[model samples]
Structures are given as structure tokens and as C-alpha cells.
Target chain A: MIWLERLLAISAKEARQLARDRVTFGMIIGVPVLQMLLFGYAINFDVRDVDAAMLDQSRTSLSRQLVGDLQATQVLRVVREAGSERELRELMQRGNARVGIVIAPDLERRLFEGNRPAVQLLVDGSQPALEKIAQGLGSMPLLKRAGTSATGVRRFEIRTEYNPARRTAVQIVPALIGTILTMTMVIFTSGASVRERERGNLELLITTPVTRGQLLAGKLLPYVIIGLIQTTLILGVGRVLFGVPMAGSFVDLYLGALVFIAASLSLGLFISTIALTQFQAFQMAFVTMLPSILLSGFMFPFEGMPAFAQAIAQVLPLTHCNEIIRGITLRGATLADMHVPLLKLVIFLVLMFSLAVTRFRKRLD
Target chain B: MTVAISARGLTRRFGAVTAVDGIDLDVPRAQIYGFLGPNGSGKSTTIRMLCGLLVPSGGTVNVLGHEVPREVETVRRKIGYMTQRFSLWDDLTVTENLDFMCRIYGLDGATRRARMKDRIRSYDLASHANQRAGTLSGGERQRLALAAATLQEPQLLLLDEPTSAVDPQNRRDCWENLFALVAAGTTILVSTHYMDEAERCHRLAILDHGRIAAEGEPKQLARDIDATVIEIECADLTAVRRVLVTVPAIRSVAQLGNRLHVLMHRDSADPERELRASLAGQCADARVERVGATLEDVFVAATQLRRPDVERAA
Candidate 1:
């Protein structure tokens, strides 16, 4: 009972202090809303409106029909017309167009023989994402669908699931839950201990009968609530503004988020123990935040990363949280289905909390 | 008298430099004991060691009958410590700060409210109870710090320079409050550089360069000073001081307004006649007389006499 009383004393004090700090209080609400708007609207992976240059040598009605079909796909727009092959190359070189379409001079004869290629597609190889779109353009049955009917065999059928429309907001909004929680939670608790030392409060506090465990636990209590509030805010905005679907239960999402919040807070407290000043604590928090954002599969595909990078990403709490959130919100997966990532989050919380408690000493020296 | 704190051969070293070197102390119970020294004389370090806020590199400390750093938890429950700086939460109100301290000390709700009310009344903080601590004046802040430290009615209070930032009027009021606490049978160990504050202590220790040069009752130490005190009044006190320093027996010279107070070795049988002889030609109208030693004279003799280079530099 006494231990609980002492722990609550510190927690109450911290909550009061946080309420008095205007900038920090503002950040609790402001950071989530601002970041939700920024990441949701700015990041787009559905590539469209690529500029292309066309060089039609046949001068026949069939070549004109091919151009119209390419435009109908909405992937490439013929922004410029070239007189010859050399002129098409110049358009790509000058950065005026990212894709080039060339029609053979004997297009009708080649189609009749079914031996030589009737059309050539030249794409700029500098931008990888745009180049992939251009490759997709090359495989479309433009000549066959344009009425020639040369090749009619279909090899395989592909289907898109979960987000069938493939909207980028749908992908980024759920991941924003992990990103926003990681940023705010880690930064809030990272400066707790260092701020006490800098302001000369640690000397007085340590001399009392309070234990190290009580101190750390009390400091982390308020920030945990703040993290949950931020998670709810992001989810609400994503659902209303971006039309992101939440197919899973809210209880399951909150349960997973609670563990991730504790893990991030423990990591901050661990940083607080090692850093000597508030500035140093902030710098160290940022260092951890960069990796969580970049390597946590929040912005890039996890499978696309190198082996060593994936190995490192496995250690970060954000990576597992992103998987858990995305699984629940988009795939309608239950906690039982994503037990692996949830278990990893609990392990991370235990490891970081133990390290923080061990590193923090009660004495000044 | 019973001993409240007993330290022996207390040593602390920070790499190559020793902050506190082999200090031996026994502070009596229910008395105002003081550590009188200049800045960096290890006053704060010794206080921290006693409270177990710092680990002594080499000695043993027994505070309030509990061994320190080993039985530190037992000691912490019985004693209250105030740091050199105002370490209370600046953003919290005075009442809130006291309430927090009370809860940390594990007082019940009824007892917590009673203690907060009593502290607010006694420390004259009723008017500022709702104001944030950061907005309080220096004197009010010091009073609040004292009230917070004593919220649990600790048996022994360790205060490190508790009145350094207050004005003289507030300082006198602070000492009066300390005396009141002592009257209530609480032992206080305070460290200070002010001579007047040191003189008020029942017992005192003079620390210099990480060592205790002298320790005893303030008046008793002054009575037993090893140097002879002489006061000289003249038209030009500076010229008399210049002439007096050349005398091999004189250890230190200090000017007090129009008079030059001189300390000579005790072996000088006729210090007054010797000083007159030294100042005969330069300031023949000077009056030289032997005087009783004050606490400042005792402090100077204890700390500055043995280090002649320091004396010369001064």
C-alpha cells in the first residue's frame, strides 16, 4: 500500500507538471492531427499521368487507334509527337517525357506475319517507380484490342484484395497509427529523468524513500494515456477523412496499441538513463525514431529491404506494431491471428523496462 | 549527549582530485551543528554523504543510528534533506508541493491535510499557497523548501546552504526558525560560509581544502585560537598593513573599516610593542592594541595560517 501511495504521488506530480507545460500539452493533440493530414495527403504510390512521346511511322488508321487505346488505360498520356526515332529519344533526354512509344514502318505486314514485333516501347530507366509503370504499359493488349486480334491467349488472372481500389491513403493511414505513437511516446518520456536532473529535482527526490522502480513507473503512467488518445485520434481522422475501413474490432486494435505504447515508453526511459542532459535525450530519441520510420515497413515494403536491414527492423517495436495495426485495420485479422507480432511487442517491453530499471541508480555518483 | 551522526575517515575521490579527504565527525543530537567553509570546501559533499545521496568512496557513515548506503533505506525514512538549490517542483503550487511530499512520505489523507495546513500557516505561505512556486520570491521559496523537507517531522534535518539566496532580514528569520526547530528537539546539520551563521551553531567545523582544520563550539574555538590578535588604527591603514606584513611573526593582515586587524604567532610575547616598532617611521601616529578574537579571526587562523602561499596570494 505504501509503495502504491508513493508511486501515485510521483505520477500525480508529473501529470500536473505536464499540464502546465503549454508546448508539450499542445503537442499531445497537435502532433497527431498535423501528421495525419500531412502523411495521408502527401504520400501517393498509385503512379499515374506519366508523360510519353509517340513516333508513329506507319501513318495508317491502325497506328492512330493504338495511341487512343494507350490513352484509355489512363497510365500514359501522349504529351508530345515526334517526327522520327531520333526526335523521340531527344524528348526523353530533355526530361519532357518519361515513356516513348514507336510504331514500326511495316506494322500491318508484321502483324500479318506474326513474327517481328509491331510496336516498340522505350522507357526512361532513371526513376524506378515510373519505369515499372511503363513496363505495365508494354504488356497491355493495345494492338490486339485495337482490332487486329493477333494474340488472344490469356496466361493468368490476377486479383487485388483487401484494398481493391489500391488507394495510398488506405495504406498510409493505418501505418500512421504506429508512426505517430512511436514519435510522441518515445519523445515524451525520454526527457523525464534528464529534465529532473537539469532542474535539480533529482537530488531532492532520490534522498527520499522512493524506489527507482516507483520513479520510472510513475513517470510512464501519464504518457501511456496520451499515447492511447493519439492512437484514437489518428484512427478517427483516417476513417472519416480518408474513408479508410476499420474491419477489425476496436478492442483488439487498442489492446495491441497498449503494448506498443508501453514498449516505446520503456525505450524512452532507457534513453533517459543513459543521457546526461535533456538535449542529449532528445537527440537520442530522434536517432531511434529515424530507424523506426524508415525500416519499420511504414513507408517501404518490408520484403524489399536487405537481409541485414530486416534483421535490425525485427528488433524495433514499431515494426511489429505496424504489422499488428495493418493486419487488424485492413485485413480484419484478430489478435489470435497476429499473435507472433503481439508476443514480440511484450518481449520488447520487458527487455526495455528491465534495462531502464537496472541502469538508473539512486545515488548521484 | 547522544550522537545523531558519526562519520570516520570519510574519503571521496573524483578521479585524481579528492573532494573530501578522511573526515572524522560526530554530531551531537538535538543541537544545531554547522560546517563552516568556503565554496568547494566539500561542505555539500559531506552533507550528501551523510544522507546517502552520495556514496563515500572510503569511510563509514552512521546517521540517526543507521549505517549509511547499507542501511540507507532506514536512514532515509528518519531524516529529511534540503539541497543547496531550490529543488521543489517549480510548476506546482505551494500547497500541491507539500501535499505531494506528504504522500511520498506515506502520510494518510487526514494526516496529509493536517500537515499541509500546518506548514502553510507556519511558513507564512498562505497568501502564496495557490501561486506557482516559480512565481514566489527567493525568501518565500526557501521557506517553502524548508516546510516541504520537514513535512513528515523528520528526526534529523540535513540542510546545505539553506539561506544562501535570501536577504539578511530573511536570513535572520531563517536562523530563528532553525532555533525553533532545535528547541523542539530536532538535530540539524547545516553547512554555510557566513561567519554569523556559523557563530549561531552550538558546535562547528572549519573545513579547508577538503580537510577539517578545526572543530568545536564556535566561542570555544575563538577562545583557543593559536594566533594573537592586534588592531591598529592610523591615518593610513594600508601603509601600516604593508609595514606589518614584513614582520616575520605576523601571519595575516585584514582591514576592517579604518582599523587593520593583524594576526601574529602566539610566541610573540609583546605583539603590540612589536607592531608599534614596525610602524614607527611610516605611521608614527598609529595606535596598536591587543584585542579578543572573534569567529572570523578564528576562521582565518584555522584556514589561512598554515597555507602561507594562500595567505600571500590573498
Candidate 2:
């Protein structure tokens, strides 16, 4: 009878508290809608209608036909036709065209004589995603020529490297590392702190002989352990299912994660210091999450952005974090190569920790 | 006796608002000092500053043998503070929460475990040791918070409105625990709104608008009010209250269930004798009984006296 009464009492209290929070209830339902609409409208992996400029050194009928066939697929458009290579190179540099197709003057004779033809495709290497797209689109002409040569003489040979499968998951999983950590740290730590203050436990804690630093460490230590566990879980799944290789030392990865967790925990502490209510902390967490997820190279590639946008993205800890993770995992980058990003993370940790400690109220205000 | 807490012109300012105004206070060791005030009267603010959670803008606070905001960590280690709210893990069991506190305080091994077990048993919470704190009742949660704060042996215990949400029975239990702590040579400064609880303190400070309006023993403050309560029982007691309201000698008239208690400013007026003659013809069956004043009457008188001064200051 006692056990039954306890169970009923606990469930009843839980239900009552859950029912009282209309906003959190709404968010649980609304968040999926928001994510669906955002992903559905804005996220697309398939490249289409990329601009191109032509520099036809051989103004031959064959060259014109090849250009026309490439344009017909709509992956490349001839935005400009330059008379010289210098002009073509300038056009590419000016961002007018993503791809520059140059055909040699002897293109028609070389192809007719069953000689392997050469077409130089000048792609902007800086824009990796668009460069990949342009390269994928540029391969179509060569494939068609290979088919046309019945005597086993191909006009051109195309080679694709680095993400040949063009799988979006490869690019997304590395970025997801930052997103998952930020989400976990922000939600759990801030929520815990705010709830304590809201429920009057903060007062009890303050009055204790425990220093503010000790209290902060105590409050944050559990969340850090939880954050690391979540990181391991995410990385584990990525490895088992997606075959994400551990290129760098696992020690290095964990160290990087420790820095990230420290930075994120400091941010959470700072937010808790400023916020009076649990609802306000939730709002602040969301406000911080949007920028971290969107601008931190998690959902978008930082290399494709302009210099100013890159500078803005640099301020986010996730930007450096993604670079560190991806470079180490994919490129097998050593500590020397990962030093700059690691340095940035260390600096972020220092700044966040210092600010949180300085502003934290040790006494009741 | 050495002072456990000593503050001189202590003040705390939050931007434009002064939460704790300039005030001087001293709490000797092993004494139960009660800070009695309504909500937003700076009791919590004063407690925080004394505990080194906040730095006073313009005052020196020496609590438990160290200056505040400088030796905060040392002082904090010697003080146990229980805030106005329950702050423990809702998902963790009682034993787990206590164990976590021990770890945070850097306590370990058999000592931490044995002491925690003893605390649970002493608090009558052994039956629910495995139960989550969130699943406990309000009174039980208070007990948990109390137990967590006291696990470490601190010289001073700062309780901020500890019994605000507790039931009357639990509030009584909390007071008993506090008194036990005092008996064990721990100085206590507890903030509370309940007068009955305040009356139990060694001495009480009545805080109003970030300043102490009065500070003395409950009986002493009541004596300072110099008011005697006269209980009047008459036919249609409503008529007696109405008559007393118009009389200048009668400071206030309140209904305590059926009988009317008339508060008189001076005994020279002899409210009982005067009221008896006035109501003799209207109701010959009227009886007047004089009674001792209570802390509630003192609180009322103190607040009433300060209103005009507060208006002028405003």
C-alpha cells in the first residue's frame, strides 16, 4: 500500500508540474516544425545552374558543339566568352564564373585524328562545395566523348578525388560534432543552474561555507561528465555506422572536447548568472544555440563564405572545433597542423572562464 | 564572548537600488539571531553579504573570524547556508545527493558515508533513503536541504526564510533542529516572516525598507511599544469595536474570533474603566479583561509608527 501510494503521488506531482509549463510543451511540438521548414527550404546538396565562362582558343565547330552540350545540361552556364586566357582568369578571380572552360586551338584536329583531346577546366579551389559541383558537371562532356570513341580511343579522361561518392553525410557528421556538443552543454547546464535558483536551492548553496568557485565547479562537474559521455556516444555511433575513422589520436580528440566542454560550461554559467528565471535561461540558451549551429560551420561550410563572414564565424568556438575535428579525422593532421584551431579554442576557454568568474555573484543581490 | 558576526554601517547596492542599507549588527557565538521582515525587506540580501556571497559596497563585515569578500572561501568553509528554496538533484536518490555533496566538499571514504547515513537516520529520512528528492513532499525536501547544508560542520548556519513554505509541524521541527545547532556552539542568523518563529529567537531584528526598524528581544520590543491589550466581551461586540475605533485613547481594535481586543497607547487612560462606563447604559452585560501584549501587536505598532516617516522620506 505504501509503495502504491508513493508511485501515485510521484506521478501525480510530475504530471501537475509538466502540465503547468505551457511554453516548454509548445516547444517540444514546435521545434520539429521549425527544423523541418528550415531544412526543407534552405538545405540542398544537388548543384544546379552554376555559372561558367568560355575561352575558345579553337573557335572550331567541334569546340562550339562541346560548349553547347555542356550548357545544355544546365549545370554550367557561359556567363562570358573571353578572347584571352588572362581575361578568363580575371573573370574567374572576379567571382563572375565558378568554372572556366578553355579549349586548345588544335582541339578539332586532335579529336578527329583519334588523339586524346585536352580541355583545361579552371575551377575555383576556394569554394570546395561549388568546386566539387563544377567538377561533377565538367565530367559529362568527357564521358560522352569516351562513349563516342568506338576504337577504344577516348577524347579525355576525368578523375574525381576526395568524396567521390559525393555523400552529404561525410560533410555533415564532422559539423554535427559541434552542433551536438553545443546543444547538450547549453541545455543541460543552464537548465540545471536556473532551476536551482528558481527553486530556492541557490540561496542554500550561497549561504554554505562553499566558495563561489567551488560551487560553480560542483554544479558544472556533473554536466561536464555528461557532455563527454554524449560526445563519446555521438562519435561511437558515427564510427560504427558511418565509418568515421579516427585519423588523429583519440587523446587529442578528447582533449579538444575537454576544451569545448569547458568553454560551453563557462558560457552556461555566464548565462545563469545573468538570468533570474528558468524560462529566461531557456531563451538565452536558444539565442546562443542558433548562432553556434548556423554560423559555426556546423550546417554550412566556412570556406565558402566571404572574408568578413569568415571573421564573424571565427568568433564562434564551433568553427575552430569543426576544422580541428575534420582535419584530424579526414586529413590525419598532426598536432602542428591543428595548433591554430586548438589555440583559438584555448583562448575561447580562457576568455569565457575569466568573464564568468568575474561577473558571477558570490552573494545574493 | 567573541562575536560570530560583526558589521558596521554595512550596505549593499544593486545598480540604482539599495537592497541592504547602512546598518550595524553583531551576533555572538552560539546564539539564535532572527531577522524578521516581510518579503523584499533586505533580509536575504543582508544574509548573502554576511555569508560573502555578495560584497557590501560600504561596510566591513567580520563573520566567523575573517573579513568578508576577501577571506570568503575560508569563511564559507566554516558557515553552512540554507537558502529559501530546495536545491538538490530531483533525479537522484537522497543518499546519492548527500554523497555528491560530500564529494563536492572533497570529503571521502568511510567518514563521508558513515556521517551521511547518520544524518539520514537522524532526520527520520532512512525509510526514503533511496527515493528521489523531487518525489518527496515539501516538508521532506526541506529536511533534505537542511541535512545537506549541515553535513559539513560549520561554525555559523545562515538560513534564508527556511520555513517559508513548510507546514506548521515541519516548521516546528526545523526550529528544533536550529536550536540543537545553537546548543552545539553554532551561531545562527535566520530570516523569517513568521512571528511565532521570530519569537523563538534569542533576539530579533525587524527590517523595513532595507533598514532595521527595531532590534531587541520579542518581550522587550513589546514592552517598548508601551501598549496594553484589553479584551472586551459584550452583547453585540460589533458595537464595542465601533465605539473603540472613534476613541483616541484606543490605539487599535481587532476581533480575535468573537471577543474584541482593544489596544490602548497608555494605561493612564484606563481603557477598560473608560469603555465600561461608556457602554454601561447601552449594554450593562459588558465585561473587560486586560491581557499581555504580543509580538504581533509590537510589529503592528512598529510598522504603524514608521509609515508617516516613510511617507515624509518618500
Candidate 3:
């Protein structure tokens, strides 16, 4: 009961202190909205309007038909025709085109001889995402369906489930809830704690009767509220403004997020215990944020990355939270379906809080 | 009177460096105790150990009859500590800072409110109650800090260089408040680098290189230093000092105002004659006279860098 009273006392004190810092409070509430808009509209991995050049050397009626086929997919728009192979290379080199369609010189004669002429799609190898998407367009359904129906055998039918439209915002906006919370939570909490240590408030607290557990818990409590508020703002904006669906129960999202936010708060506290100055704390927090954004499947699919990167992603709190958010919002995942990630977050919180308290000495040493 | 804090063979180390080594201390109740040392001499380290903010690398510490770092919780409940740097919540108002500390110390509602009102008046913080602590002037901030530290009526107060930032007027007022606390039967242990402040303590300890060089009343420390004080007047006191320090019998040389106050080995029976002869032999003209020792001389003599042979042995 005494520890609880002291916890409440320190929490109220921190809340009052943060309330007086108008700029910080404004940023805490404003950044998520700004970030949601920025990431939701701008981060589209579904590549479109790809610039394409046609090098139809044959110039025959059949080759003309193929050019129309590429354009019908709406992904690649043929913008130029190369006079020769050298000119086609020039189009790619001048940055005028990202994809090039090349047809053989004598396709009809080669077809009559029963030895098929070589046709190729040359693409810019730079920008791996653009390269992969452009290559996929070359093999789009327009080309495949026009070439063959192979009516002799039967192939199994495929069906897409949950996010059948493959909307990046549907996935990214929900994941942004985790990212915005991660950045703001680490920035607000660790920055505040390290500033106190630098300014001597932490030292003063150490001399008080408050235990380490109470002090850390109290210091992080205010930031947890800030994290929750930020999470809710991002989520609400994501659902209403961006049309990201909330397929699962709100209770599932809230309960999952509580554990996820605790993990982030504890991570920040661990960073504060190690950082001697506010600058160091800020640097450390951002360094942690980078991995969360890159490896959390927020920007890229987790399965698409290399196995080693997947291993690193497994340890990050943001990775699991990203999965939890996307699963609940996009897949209509229930609380039962999210136990693995929630359990991971809980385990991470326990370890991080323990390490933080153990590393945080009462002495200046 | 029962001692408020007592330590025996207390030691603290960082890697290979020993900060507080084999030091013993006894601070009595209802008295002002001063800790004096030069930079890196471990004054702050000792105060931290006594407050149970730091663990002794060896030996033991007992504050208010509780073993330190083990019964540190009990000690923390009874003692209030003010650090060398400003430690109050900078973004909070003056009243909010005091309220926070009172709650942290588990003060109940009525007592908290009454003491908060009393300190706000006595500490000259009534007009600045709603001002953010970061915007306050240096002196006003220290006043707020002291008011917050003492808001709970702690039994023993530990202050580490509490006046290092304030102007002279505020420093005087701050010491007046400290004396008032002592009058109310609160034990105070304060560390300071100022000689004037050191002279104000009832009992004091001079630390040098993590060891207690001397401990007693300031005047007693002055009287007990084993050195002959000789003041020299000359056109070039620097030149005279250079010649006098070359003599093995002369232990140290320090310039006070226009003259040099030289300390010689106590065994040197003819200190004045020895100093003048040494200066004259080097063809430096000077006048020498024996002078009574002061607390400044005691500090210099107690912390004098010992010869290499003696230092290594210790």
C-alpha cells in the first residue's frame, strides 16, 4: 500500500512536470497524426505508372498487339520506341525509362520453323523494389492469358483471403500505430528520465525512501499514458481517415497494446539506465527505433527478408506488435489468435524491467 | 550525546582507484559537521556513503543506529539529502516540488499541508510559489531546493556543497537556516571547499586522497598542525619562496596577500633563521617573522603532497 501510494505520488508529479512542458506535450499528441498522414499516403509499395520503352524491332502487326497487351495491365505505360539496341540502352541510361520490351527481328519466320524467337524484358536493376515489381508486370496476366489456355490438364484454383486487394495502407496504417508509439514512447520516456538524472532529480529520488521498482514504475507511468493516447490517436485516424478496418474486437487491441506499450516503456527505461546524458539517451532511442521501422515488417514483409534479418526481427518488440496490430485490424484476429505475440511482449517487459532496475544503481557510479 | 552517523574503516573504490580508503567518522547529534578537501579528495564520496546512496567497498556505515546499504531504507526514511547540484523538478512550480517530496516521504495530508505552508513562508518562497523552478534565479532555486528537502521535517539532513552556486548574501542566509535546523536538534553534515564555511562547523574532518588527514574543531585543527609558520616580506616573494622550498627542512610555501607564509618541519628549531639564511644564500633579499597558524594553514599542511617515498609506503 505504501509503495502504491509512492507510485501514485511520483506519477502525479511527473504528469504535472510534463504538463508544464507545453512543446513536449504538443509534440506527443501532434506527431502521431502527422506521422499517420505522412506514412499512410506516401508509403505505397504497390508500384504503378512504370515508364516503359518498346524496342519492337520487327514492327509487325503481331508485335503491335503485344505492345497493347503491356499497356492494358495499367502498370506499365509505353512512353518511347527505340530505333536500335544502342538507342534502347540510351533510353534506360538517360533515366527516361525503367522497363524495356524487346521483340525479336523475325518472329513470324522463327515461329514457322518451330524454333521460337527470343523475346526479352530488360529492366533497371537499381532500386530492388522497383526492379521486382517491373519484372512482375512483364509477366502480368495480360501476357499469360493471351499466350495459353492449356486445356488438357486441370490446375488447382487459388483464393486470396484477408486484404484481398493488397492495400498497403490497410497494413501500414495499423503497423504505424506500433511505430508511432515506439518512437514517441522511447523519446518521451528515456529523454525525460535521462534529463532528470543529468539534472539531479533522479539522484534526489535515490536518496528518498522510494524503492527502485517504485521509482522506475512511477517514472514510466506518465509515458505509458502518453503512449496509449498516441496509440489511440494513430489508430482512430488510421481507421476513420485512412479506412483501415478494425476487424477484431477493441478489447483485443487494447489488451494487446497494453502489453506492447509496457515492453516499449521498459526498453526506454533500460536505455535511460545506461545513458549518462540526454543526448546519449536520444541517440540510443533513435538507434532502437531504426530497427523497429526497418525490420518490424512495417515497411517490408517479414517473410520476404533474409533468414538472418528475420532472426533479428524476432527479438524486436516492434516486430511482434506490428504483427499483433495488423493481425487484429486486417485479419480480424481474435485474442486467442494473438497469444503468441502478447506472450512475447510480456516476457520482454519482464526481462527489460529487471535488467533496467538491476543496471540502475542508486549511486552515481 | 548519541552519534548521528558513525563509520569505521569505510572504503570505496572504482576499478583500481580507491576513493574513500580506511576512513573513520563520528558525527554527533544536533551539531554542524563539515567535510573539507580539495578537488578529487573524496568529500562528496563520503557524504554519499553516509546517506546510503552509495555502498562502501569495505568496512561499515551506521547512520542513526542502522547499518547502511542494508538498512538503507530505514535510514532513507529518517534523513533528507541535498546534492551539490540542483535536484528539484525543474518544470514544476515551487509548491508542486515541495508537495511531491512530502508525498514521496509519505507525509500525511494535514502535516504535509502545514509544513508546506510553513516552509513557503520561512524559505522566502511565498511569492514564487507558482513560478517554474527552471526560470528561478540561482539563489532562489537553491532556496526552493532547501525548502523542498526539509519540507518533511527529516531528523538528519545531509547537504553536499549546498551553496556552491548562490551569491554571498544568499550564502549567508542559507547558513542561517542551517543553524536554525541544528537548533531544532537536527544533525547536519555538510561538505564545502570554502575555508570560511569550514570554520563555522562544530566538528570537522579534513580529507586528502581518500584518507582522513585530521578531524576536530577548526581552531583545534589549526593548533594541532605540526608546522612552524613563517611569513616572508620581499620585493620578489616568488624568488624568495623558490629558494626557501629548496631547503629540505621547509615543507611547503604559499602566498598570502603580498607575502609568502612558509611552513617548516616542526623539528627545525630555528625556522625563521633557517628561512632567512636559505633566501640570503641564494642572494635573495627578504624579511622573515614567525606567525600564528590559522585554519588555512592547517588545511594546507594536512593536505600537503607527501614525498614519493612516504606516499608509496602509505
Highest lDDT model number? 1
The candidate maximizing TM-score is 1
TM-score of each: 0.97, 0.75, 0.88
In TM-score terms, candidate 1 sits at 0.97
Better of 2 and 3 by DockQ: 3
* Highest DockQ against the true fold, candidate: 1
- A1-365: candidate 1 lDDT, tens digit per residue: 99998998898999999999999999999999999999998887777778999999998988888889899988889999999899999999999999999999988888777678888889889976787677667667667765555543345555678999989899999999999998898888988778998999999998888999999999999888889999999999999999999989899999999999999999999999999998999999999999999999998899999999999999999999999999999999999999999999999999999999999988889
What overall lDDT goes with each candidate model?
Answer: 0.91, 0.75, 0.85
Per-residue error (Å), model 2, residue B235: 1.1
lDDT of 1 by residue, B134-200 (tens): 9999999999999999998999999999999999988998888899999999999999999999999
* lDDT (tens digit, per residue) of candidate 2 on A1-365: 33333233333333333344576445433433344334433554666677889999988776887888788877788889998999999998999988999998887555556556557788888875787676566445453543345333345775544445555555666556666777667765677677777776566555544445555655566556655666676676566655656767777777777778877887887888888887898899889888777787776666778888788778888888888877766667766688998899889888876777787775565
Instruction: Judge candidate 2 against the unseen true structure and give its global Cα lDDT, from 0 to 1.
Output: 0.75
lDDT of 3 by residue, B128-207 (tens): 99998989999999899889888768789999998899998998999999999999999999999899899999999999
True-contact fraction per candidate equals 0.95, 0.53, 0.88
Tens-digit per-residue lDDT, B75-174, candidate 2: 8778877877677767667987787666545455677888798889878799899898889998888888888888887788888888877899999998
- Looking at candidate 3, what is the lDDT of residue A263? 92
Residue A365 alpha-carbon offset, candidate 2, angstroms = 2.5
Model 2: per-residue Cα lDDT at residue A183: 69
Instruction: List the candidate 3 regions with Cα displacement exceeding 4 Å.
Output: A57-66, A104-120, A130-159, B228-292, B305-314
